[model samples]
Target chain A: MLGLSQQALLRLPWRRSLESIALPVIALTAALIIFGGFCAMAGANPFQVYGSIYKAAFGRWSAWQHTLILSAPLMLTALCTALPARLGLVIIGNEGALVMGGLAAMATGLGLGITLPPLMVQLAMAAAGMAAGGLWIMLAGALRYYRGVNETISSLLLNYIAIAIMNHLVEGPMRDASFVIKPSSAELDPANWLGAIPGSRIHFGLLYGLVVCLLAYVLIQRTPFGFAARIVGGNIRAARIAGLPVGKLTLAICFLGGSAAGLAGMVEVAAVQKRINQSLVSNYGYAGILVAFVSRHNPLATILAAILLGGILASGGILQRSHNLPDATVLVFQGIVFLCVLYSESLYGKFPCFREGEG
Target chain B: MAAESLGLWGIPLGILAGTLRGSAPFLFVSLGECLTEKSGKINLGLEGVLLMGAMSAYGVSYLSQDLVGDFWAPWLGVLAAGFSGMALGTIHGWVAQQPRVNDVATGIAMITLGSGLAFFFGKPFIQPQAPQLMTFDWGAWSSSPQVQAALKVSPLFLLGVAIAPLLYAFFRSTRWGLSIRAVGDSPQAARAMGISIFKVRLFSIMAGSFLAGIGGACLSLYYPGVWTERISSGQGLMAVALVIFAQWNPIQCLWASLLFGGAQAIGPTFQSVGIDSYYYLFNAAPYILTLIIMIITCSPQRTLSGSPGALGKSDHT
Candidate 1:
């Protein structure tokens, strides 16, 4: 069983929060063992691989910065999944939103005639990106509310459509025309670009993602709308009986989730890539789902999960370069950890220690 | 000149060919999912099963060096895929039956696992071409270019078509199929009648995944002899949509797969015709059609009722 119930966790003092961390600690240990087996299968030394991964992901300050850079988008993308999940709406359109957001941010950069200050351009890009993403998800939510379509399938279809649209635009209309091999839009001005953290390749996006996560946590856990959404997710019949505005709330939360991911997209464009390309999707949206699942939909826990997974992702290039392991080696490890973490859910209410008097 | 370029004759012919080639994988995967769903368990992991099937089939055929052609390669690949599917399904059934693990979440995870493994193995096959299956040259009967193109159906297409009536007959007449359906319709009722709901559902998921694996294998061996990471991109997931579009019937699966195939083929058709706008529209067609079909079929009046009772019966739904 998971160690602490909602009521118990709330009632416990700050000292008991340490006990709650036990689940993830145990889960992380289990993950290492499983990944060790995978390393054996791949004909690599497990200890050596582990050592290399640690060195590449966090042993150096630069590696840790890169890890945070990767973690930035994942954090917001986690919200894109986690928020709607609170309302029992599986709106998996974050990647699509991210694409749209990137397009919007790129377009803003291209279309803006006046040379504004860096802060103003960044703010405008974020707003535009979030709007594009928010609008895209709003359509899905609207269709689910009014037209009775399944959001999961529609959102997924929208992702393909968005990717195709991105491809078409970059290849045909918005293409810079000079770059023959890899078509991309005109790069944003370096003056307008986001600055990196002091002495790190990491940008301010990590701070932004963490702030969004904190805000999402408060919105989902403390706000009235969050309370109503939970009730709706639990039971629509009960929610309707309780006079909750289910349809509007669904649309609103979905929009907020989309905006979070859209912001991540803008940050990627402004901070990391500085150009919108097909590489916008490095499976961050998909990986975010695993992060959300491992965190059990709690926004704050997603930070740790995303950072942990980000470390693995950061080390993937190192593993591929050093051991000649396939880049997908990281994928296998993530898959193993994801499956084990999910399976560990069975332990939640079953543990004798968590039983009435045992703890 | 416009009329000649239009090649109106090519439209129907291409649709027919598209239906056969495109629908083969859909047909196979849907029939498998149909069986699984009939037993009251929906396994979304078929997408991964299909990917693994493609990888294994392609890997084996490439290693075999085409001495025997790729004819038997997919069959062998399907077997491996089926074995993998059964293994994954067993885990799904076990965890789901535990009353703690969520089937949908578990399925999503298994999908990632299957795809990860497929890409790991499929990395070796990015450039080298596997031995392709020999075409029967059925176009010998037709002089027209369009007709010839339409006539060249893969043997897997024929195999998938053949599976339709066989599955229909099995569902209508066979004891196991009927028991599976009974368990799906009402596990509680089936349990009352002394049936093992867990056992039936387990068998259903395994069988469903096996068929999906064959469908995946067909993509690599017959259609295009090369494998890529994106080869099975949305085919597996789209097949899930096809099951709903087919109304959970094996015969309907054929029609549904063909329709999906036609929609998919339109993108290439636009390129061949040199219609730039059509290219964009055509690319968007399948997803739009699928979304429309889902909305229409799932409408209040036409709501599907014969699906496995447990399908989508989540706490939220």
Candidate 2:
């Protein structure tokens, strides 16, 4: 009887997983249809617009390079939300952590001057960024665990505060004298700049993102700690009864997630911007939330979702130039996708095929 | 030396003026959120709603000025903003009621949708000059031109102030208000009492959204007096935090909003007095204040008595 019940449970999840995948796919298709209607209302043929988007984002070698570059940061930041989500915490202050991480990295680079070896300086910058980001997000976790503060609200408010702090530093005390037009820190020495891949325009950050996400996938799916975290997420009261270290797990997961986001900021500074400035606080943090949600908080799936979103963002300029549409037009598409995906959550477990004894 | 002292005194006076002017948007948004939360749903998407409202209000004011002249344009623009907010709120309410929909995630999506639609449609209105709402020169009694300029108050500001006590009375005395509170505190109990949870919550959300839209209109049609992509600047989000700080009391919201307004005014006030040091830090005061407030009020040891029991929780039934 035990073996039979176990077999039945195993069979049910396979069908359940199939439905989970099918529902989101359907939602995405519906969202695309709605987006197409909007485009048609704007006087552009929806098919032509989608075709141009595809051509611009993935059709050419140069386009692929751009998408890969954008995806690198997104993958890292998406982890920020995904990991915390495993503990049933919604942390959206990845932007704040990214900004602070970038600032910390920049400060470390400038503070070290040129005394250390180039590799050492780069390592130090990464460390600074990770530490800053980890602490910043950990504050939200701590607040939630200890103070009953809502992680979502606290983290988001922290984003505003972090940006303000960055602005204060960049525009005031840390302003580089020669960089008058835009207040920025002194650029990192050329020796410290992250090198691009030999055959492509994409840098080492893409590899870093993939490796980190893979490691995260392994940790979440294959570890005892992850098992405990899942238990906590499934039911906190039960987790307490089980004697699980819920507080410690929450803080550790939040820290790890925040460190990934911080590293993304460092990569943006070292590999792309080559300096820290106001531009570092781009919407990658917010976009990562969408990516995480689309991936259903799975680290492995986050990589694919990040790349897809990166391609959409990469096509914005092309849409503007070719279709006379504003760059923000894509935001409408993303918003629709987000809504449909959230709505699709209702469709899960309701499908007839997934019903017990159907097979 | 006398002029310097006068300038010093102007800082306080300027802050007082800023409190009255700046608190209007905060007051309206917080009250709106307050009403919604009282019905057991938190609409964090009000940030995006405010942005869309601002954009639509500006666009309508600009268009109506061309068609009907300035006399009626601003009021018509306010109406358009409220309508836009209601539409978005309806989407949120409907989605929230759907099975398995997470209110927080849905709220986030709504934010993206509202802001995306606003930005996509607002491009044309960026350069147009919309008719601005009129303001009363209450400072005319002062001899200083500086004081007179500082004291210019929009009529919307007065309306926001008046609405606070009215909302307090609404919650205290009205049947609908009691119904909303009942739905919020105990949905099972409310349902047993023959109340329709869906209708009460949905109508409450729509009404709250209308108030938030008025707040957005105040931002574009009065103070800043121009439509820009950044007009709302997270004021709607800040108002969410403000509602918590107010402990869900409408009257307390007035005091909390003024405090936030004062925090916002610090930067400009200091600048006017030639104290440019740490200006950006001063600009960050409101966010800092919000963080501090959340820390103080959100203690796990004590339950927040004013919080609606059902707020932010999914109703499995």
Candidate 3:
């Protein structure tokens, strides 16, 4: 009976779309319940933990500021995964691209110094960052298309190399010398720092994220280029048969993804951190991959996913303070949610809810 | 025991020691990955498996000691680590077998799940002491304590070494192994022959994860011999790259593991000599070496030449 129903479910059209919307909601609810169980096992009241998390994440205007601030980098870094995923590529080197972009941005900002106008210097920094990150990720794409190396492995390896290069520079050639306790590069001029949005504590980086995500959505969903990209992603053979530039599309999409991550790094440095240091290696890039996945690789949906994850991250400290939970409690929750999302993708079309004669 | 006695010669000696110690995790993890990839699946969550294994082994060793004796405690810890890895493997394998599931993405999700579970449970045990594995005294003939110490090999390493040849023979001579190979190389052909691709692939995956868990045990129980959150610095992840470089050959995994171990030892060896200037650069040796290996060995012309025909981007695994 179950197998017959599954076959019938596959024959329906609107049922598929309905499943996509319903499945994720059900999956997220299941994940929340599982997380509550885990919290209980860890000796905390699940309800209290959930309450604290809610209060910390979205309770007040000030709390929203923290969530939005954290969401900025996530929105950008998530693009690094979401964009390439559209081209049927799995690139997880957002961390590497971000690191290289930040490093390049730092060099460009420091190289220009106070010689140029602050706005111009910041613009140059953004360009350099995007270029570095783009090229960095593009290398993985090139390797995949040209050499047949697995993009996932190559990208992950690049992450370590980028971090290594950052560490070398910060400890050696670019060391600021003032920080005896920690290794870091020279700070950018305060005049050149990214300012907050009008009447709010949120930085301009948040605007950059929203605009970029919007542009990316339009680029992938509306533009002819996006159509071409989807064609290449949907079927490489059909793409080749249609005389589409599969290799170029693959490389370009990868470049765009990397540039998004790189911009996140630049935003982190210029907006939040005034200097390049060990603090820049925060797992924003890794977390962004989760955002991309939870959003099902949709650039626009990434906005919501990033905010969701950002709220979880913001609640980390609150959970720790109120529930005496470990800081890793947030990670546990994120991981549970991610697993649930992935598992839910498997259940599509399994449940047949066909309106009578509407099939 | 004196540092001066091993001077000048100490670098190579230290490298030998490091290679013996560090290579165990690499060997076990790669061998496990080799087994999975041989059946046309990849377990990228082995990093999480490794961490989970490390955390569980240390925790079990500490907790089980009061129930059992010291010797039994560490052994029980090893057993628990394998079972825990198998538990995760069950999840990954089940999800992987579902239609339209991307193995790469599932592997990534499994990684997050494994690490989160490990870290949440691993926090309390980080500060506690656990019993370590027994080591063999191969260097007993040498008068130098450093030489004797360097020669002490973990039994787990030998087990890995022994398993390499056995695994090679299994794939070469055993019926079940041949079935795994057929399923991995050509799922359609295997399906035509009435082989259940689902069962074979699931078994290979779970067994592979079991080995990876033991590799984690080799890490926390043997070499570093302690529980720390940062015990593994991507060894589980790198092992996958290592397996690719080894061309999925089980015997080749051993040599590649030693090479990886030497690369891992570069920074520590230099630091031992107080040459810590480029410490971070040298620390990236394994990743750099893996990338270089991939670039050199993995060209379109040669890709999957020795790999199971169905490996990477395939729906089956």
The candidate that achieves the highest lDDT relative to the unseen native structure: 3
- Per-residue accuracy of model 3 over B64-160 as CA lDDT, tens digit each: 8889978889888888888888888888888877776677767877777788788878999988788888899999999989889889999999999
Winner of 1 and 3 under TM-score: 3
Error of 2 at A295 (Å): 1.8
Residue lDDT tens for model 1, B92-186:
66655545455656666777778878888789887887766555668878766666666777877787888887988888899888888888777
Instruction: Provide per-model DockQ scores.
Output: 0.48, 0.70, 0.56
lDDT of 2 at B251: 96
Candidate 1 fnat reads 0.44
The TM-scores of chain A alone, one per candidate, are 0.93, 0.95, 0.93
lDDT of 3 by residue, A1-359 (tens): 99878766666656666676788889888989999999899899999888888889999999999999999999999999899998889899999999999999989988898999999999999999999999999999999998888898899999999999999999999999997868999998888888999989999999999999999999999998999999888998899999999889989999999999999988988998878888999989888887887788888889998998899889988987888887878878887887788778777656656332345
Cα lDDT tens digits for candidate 2, A196-226: 9899999998998999999999989999988
Which ranges of candidate 1 are over 4 A from the true structure?
A: A1-20, A113-115, B1-16, B64-74, B93-100, B143-150, B299-306, B315-317
Model 3 residue pairs with clashes: none
lDDT of 2 at B205: 86
Which residue pairs overlap in candidate 1's backbone? Answer: A1-A347, A1-A348, A1-A349, A1-A351, A2-A348
TM-score of chain B, candidate 2?
0.94
Candidate 2 CAPRI-style tier: medium
Top TM-score prediction, candidate number: 2
